[model samples]
Target: MAKITYIEFTGEEHVLDLEIGTSIMQGAVDNSVQGITADCGGACSCATCHVYVEPEWLNKLGDKSEMEEILLEEVCQPQANSRLSCQLKVSADLDGMIVRLPESQF
Candidate 1:
């Protein structure tokens, strides 16, 4: 399992143990973690699951897909490091990934 540390804009942090090969959105949803709405399930259609990859961990995550890149623009506060959690598949190399939640999910 990969350990994902999620931090909110307010600096609140929560760690979740995600099964390998599962998407970040699924990990959050399965654990009922707050801040990840995942309105579109794991299809990468909705930006509600948006999160900002911490600078140190950005290079460790998967590259953004064309679909995810398009949807990120609609997220609350898109940043260069922004990604849809649904697009981030957990892996052994990403064990200590840290993602920051936006202030809003709309």
Candidate 2:
């Protein structure tokens, strides 16, 4: 399992131990983390699960898919680190990953 940290825009942090292969969105939703709404579940159709991967860990995460890249453009406060949590799968390589939520999902 990977231990991931989710930081809300307000600065609150939720840390969780997520099983391998689970999407980051699923881990947040299952733990009731305050930031991710996951409006489309893990389907990648919604940008509600938008998050900013910490710069230090960005390279560890593979490049975003075309669909993820397109949806990210529509998220609030898109940035160089912006990504859809639904597109990130948990794994040993991602342990200690930290992601910051946008001020708003809309």
Estimated TM-score per prediction? 0.93, 0.97
What does candidate 2 score on TM?
A: 0.97
Among the numbered candidates, top lDDT falls to: 2
Per-structure clash totals for the candidates: 0, 0
lDDT for 45 (candidate 1)? 85
Candidate 1 — which residues are off by over 4 angstroms?
none
Error of 2 at 17 (Å): 0.7
Which 10-residue span in candidate 2 carries the lowest summed lDDT?
68-77
Model 1 residue pairs with clashes: none
Worst 10 residues of 1 by lDDT: 69-78
lDDT by residue (tens digit), candidate 1, 1-106: 8899988778888898888999988888887778899988888788899998888888887688889888887877788898898988999999998998888999
Write one digit per residue (lDDT tens) for candidate 2, span 1-106: 9999999989999989999999999999999998899999889998999999999999888889999988988987899999999999998999999999989999
